[model samples]
Structure formats: structure tokens, C-alpha cells
Target: MAAEIRTFTCLTDNFGYLIHDPATKATASVDAPEAGPIIRALEREGWTLTDILITHHHGDHVGGVAELKQRYGCRVVAPHDKSTKIANVDLRVVNADVIKVGSLLARVVETPGHTLDHVSYVFDAEKVVFAADTLFSIGCGRVFEGNYPMMWDSLLKLRALPDDFRLYCGHEYTASNVKFALTVEPDNPALKARAEEVARLRAENKPTVPTLLGDEKKANVFLRADEPSVAARLHMKGADPAQIFGELRERKNKS
Candidate 1:
């Protein structure tokens, strides 16, 4: 009676997740970066495509919607703000909206920064989040649609979630991101242990996502803006937390 979530790497780095509810043999794809892998997974699991959830309008995230929708005639769900760009959306949802995958419920979290129309789905009942590009494993998405302050605000909202919440980010860039993190906190023991573990995982070409929020808070500098050590490293000069986060984002963009 166990529900399973299967992830397939699409494009070069993007991830496409399929949450399978065995009880109903229903599946939902978090983002459709590509159709080939997703189509294959559906066949492999003998699951019906119940829904397609889009986090943002980015091409890498929604490029396969039309094809997949036509293939399975699945219901498409997207953020209400980007309904215009999301083709054939069945339900335009807003923040706090709850949707179901069989019996499990997932709440929509309006997290904008990487994109103004961005949203992340939080499966609070399962302690899992489909964070898209808002919050990565060790690094966040580069600011493209919003500024430092907006991104900082968005990140703060996510940081406030329960420590045990597991983050399922959009990309498989943990190894490189960990390398950049070391430049910011070279002496952090947590970062050191995680880096070694990430190296081993990447060496075997394994995915390094779905990290716990508490672990990211300790090792990821972007999630550590409130800490004195990160503040000093970013040379906040006694500025507020928002200002410090802004500075670090700018530095990373240039780094």
C-alpha cells in the first residue's frame, strides 16, 4: 500500500517526477521538461496519467505539456498567474490551494523569484516539496524574473518551513553547487561531509536532490543568511538579513 515517487532526468539537467498512487494506479508529473522519459515511466509503472502540474512557464519546465497532454489526455494544472502561457490548463490554482493525488493532498505554495509566476507544491502530509527552481539542493536558481530582494523574500518563506521537510528541486546540479558553496564556507564541517557525499553520488551519476530542509540550512549558504558566520563571510557590514541575502545573491551571480 506504499505510494511511490519516481524521478527521471530530462533534457540536460532538469528532473521530471511521477508520483504514483498504487491504490488508484494514478500518477502526476511535477514538471514536463521532456516527453520521452515521462512517457516511458508511465508505461513502465502501468500508471494512468492523472494530472500534469506546472510550476512555472519556463520552457525547460513546461515544454512537453502539449505533447504529453495529447498523448494521455491528462488534466493540466498550473499557477493562476500564468494560465495565459500554460496551454490547455484544466485548473488555474492559487497559493494555498490543495490538490489530491489519489488520497495524498498537496498544497500550492506561491514562491516567486526565479519567475514571477513561480509556485511550489508542498505535500505537507508527506513532508515533501516540489520546489522547481526556487530552492535547489545547495544552490538556488539564478534570478531571471525578479531582483535580489524579491528572491531573498521568497527564500525566507521556504526557510520557515519545517526542518524535516524534504526538498525536491528541479535540477541535478548538486556537485557543482557544492563546489561553489565551499568557496563561501570552507571551514564548515557540515559542508565538508556533504561535499564528500555529493562527490561519491555524482561519481556514480546518482541524483543528489530531495535533501532535508535542516541539512540545507546547515550546509547551503543561501539558506544560512541569518547565521553570523555567513553574514560575516558575505561582508554584510551589519546590514539586516534581507540586505545580507541580497549581497550574497549578487556575489553568486557574478561568481
Candidate 2:
């Protein structure tokens, strides 16, 4: 049988996700922004939480972990980086680690940038990627704990995923991301089309998570630093991709 995934809003702009594997009757929360909504989702699905897979130590992402774990006695999986300082960890994982939530399997990919301890989870069989702060639908996270080149490398790692993978980010920043993206690639037809789509989704007070990786690659300017047109638009022709990426990130920070 197929696993079920549920997504809901939490803590203002944060997103909370629950994935349940019916075969083993196991359920895991991608990140816990808060407890109420996650509990509600579990109640609605009638699935018991067995694990909490943390992408990073950010408060908004981990705020509900302790409460939920105490309530369910769920196992908490976290990053291998000790500097992240996440408490209540049952297992600490690094890149290429295989984590199990009953019969469901997730591969870890270290994607430090926003934070050196940040990680992304990929359920390849399910074709889903929980990238958290590393990547967004039309943008990427600001490089806070790591340098621009490190962040660029992290973005490249995600961009290398299969184009068909579904991307689940940490927030609802699509509309604003699209607006900033336009200034970078004003003439991109794909971006222009996606802007209209994002506008409609936001107008209805809907969430725009779980977008296709392929769509993001085409429309997300942050992933297009290597594109000649993008470089030309930024007036940085024939530049190193990392340098171009750095420039784009600097502009986004200011935008």
C-alpha cells in the first residue's frame, strides 16, 4: 500500500508535514513548528506518530518536537553536526545515511548554508524531497551560517536530484520569491507563467508546497546562476557559476 502525506500551516508562515506508512503503520513529522496542528493532522489521519525527522535546529522547525515526542514517545532523528545543538535526538545522521520510519526509508543529504547543520531528506521511492531551508519553490534560503560558495554547492547538490522529484520546502514564500525572481529573469517566459500561477494560489489563501523539482529548476532564478541569459541579465557574462550564484544571492538578500 502507498504511504499518505499531509501538510498543514503552523506558526504563522511555517509549514508542518506528516508522512504515514500504512504497511507498518508508522508516521513521522518532517519538522514540528507547533504541536496543535500536527496533533490535529494525526487525529484526522488516525495515524500514530512514531518518529520526528528534523531538517535542522531552527526553532520554528523544531519547536513542537519535544511536546510531540513526550506525548507519543516517538523517536527523534537529527543531524550529525553537534554544533546544531538540537535536544532530544534519538539518532544523529549525516549525508547518505539511510533512516527508517518503519518500512519507509529516507536518505539524508547534508545541505548546509542557511545553517551548517541543515540537512534535507529524500524519500526516493516516494519521489519527495523535504528540503526545508536549503531550497524553496522560487528561491533558496539566505546563507547565514555558511559562505556563498558553500551555499551555492548546497543548492547544486539539490539541483542534482532527479527532475521529477517533488520538493517540499519549509515556508510559504513562493509569491514573494516570484516577485524577486522577475527582477532577475524578467524575460523568462517560464517565470512569467509561474508568477501568474503563484498569484492565483496566494489569492485563494492556499499553500504552494510539494512543487516539482523540474518546475523549480526552470522558474527559480536561484538555480539559474549558470544560465547564460541569467548571467547576461545580471551583467556577469562568462563568470564562474559559484561567483554568479554569489552575486544572485547578494541581490536576493537586498531584495
Candidate 3:
């Protein structure tokens, strides 16, 4: 049977995910944003936490790791690169590493950009990706630790994934991200439709997590940096994809 994944809110805007494999009764928390919410979710689901898969070392991301580890005694799986400290790690993984959660297998994808040690977990068997910080529903993480080119390259790695993959990103910034995308490609029908849809979703105070990669490619401006039309929109025809991405990210930062 396929892995059962749950998404819930954490902190102010961050998201929390729990991936459970029923066959072996193995459950893994994608990240420990906060111990309270995670504990509540576990109690609600009646699933015991067996592992914690960390994507990055940001405060919000790892804030509850220690508490959760103490409370549940769950194994903590973190990235190999330790530019930032993440305590209580049982396994340190790198790109191409395969992590097993029960019968479920997740391929570690090193997508450093928002942070040099950042990583994404791809559950290829389930066609789902937990892209914390590095990628978002309608946007991407800011280039805080890596250069523009490095960030762009990291994004490319995600973009290379199959379009059918379901992307479970870090935060709930789709509303603002979609608004910013309109200014970049105002005439894009897909983007325009997405903006309207996002507006309705937000108006109802709904979560827009688990967006499809295919739809994101068609609507997300940042993902289209390599598209000639996107470059032309900024009067930057023939510019390198990395340069276009940098310009788009800069504009988004200011927006």
C-alpha cells in the first residue's frame, strides 16, 4: 500500500507533515516545527512517531526537534552538511541517499540555496516531495546562504523532477507569491487563473499545500526563469536562466 501523508499548520505560517506507512506501521515527521502541534497531530492520528526527517537547520524548522526527540525518542535524520547545528541527529544524509521509512523509500535531494546544507526528500514511489525552504507552492526560498547562480541551480534540480509529483512545501505564502508573479508575467493566462483561484482559497482561510508540480511550472514565475517569454517580459531576451532567476528573485524580495 502507498504511504499516507498528513499536512497541518505549525508556528505562524510554516507547515508540518507526517508520513506514515501502514504496512510496517512506521511513521515519520517531515520536520519538527513545533512539538505541541506535532504531538497533537500524533495523538489525533493515533500514530506513534518513529522518525524525524529534517530538511534544513533554520530555527523555525528545527525548533521542536529536541523536544520531540525527548518526548518520543524518535530517530532524527538530518542533512550531512553541518553549516548550522541540528542536535539529536541519528543519521546524516546527503544527495542520492535513500531513506527508508517503514516500507516507503525517500530519495534525498541536496538542493542547497536557501541554506548551504538544505535538502529535499523525494518519495518517488509515492510521487511526493517534501521541499522545505528550498521550494514553495508559488515561490522559492530566498538566497541567504548560496549565491544567485547556486540558488538557480538548486531550483533546477527540483524543476527536473517529474511534473506529476506532488510538492509539499514549507510555508503558506502562495497568496503573496501569486500576487508577485502577476507583475512578472501579467498576460499569462495560467498565472491569471491561478491568482484568482488562490484568492478564493485564501478568502476561505484554506491551506494550499500539496500543489502539483505541473501546475506550478505553468503558473509560478520563478520556475519559468528559463523560459524565453519570461526573459522577454523583463526586456532581457537571451539572458542566461540564472541571470533571469536572479532578477526575478530580486524583484520578489522587494515585492
Candidate 2 scores a C-alpha RMSD against the true structure in Å of 0.9
- Whichever of 1 and 2 has more lDDT, that candidate is 2
lDDT of 1 at 185: 96
lDDT of 3 by residue, 1-255 (tens): 888888899999999999999999889999899999999999999999999999999989999999999998999999997667898999999999999999999999999889999999999989999999988977999999998898889888998999999999999999999889889889989888888888888889888878899988899888899999999998999999999999999999998
Q: Model 1 residue 42 lDDT? A: 89
Model 2 stretches astray by more than 4 angstroms: none
Candidate 1 lDDT score at position 89: 88
* lDDT value, residue 150 of candidate 1: 82
* Candidate 3: residue 255 lDDT (0-100): 89
Query: In model 1, which range of ten residues has the least summed lDDT?
Result: 81-90
* lDDT per residue (tens digit) for residues 6-76 in model 2: 98999999889998999999999998989899999999889999999999998999999889989999999
| Residue 18 lDDT in candidate 3 | 97
Name the lDDT of candidate 2: 0.92
What is candidate 1's TM-score against the reference?
A: 0.96
lDDT of every model, 2 decimals: 0.87, 0.92, 0.92
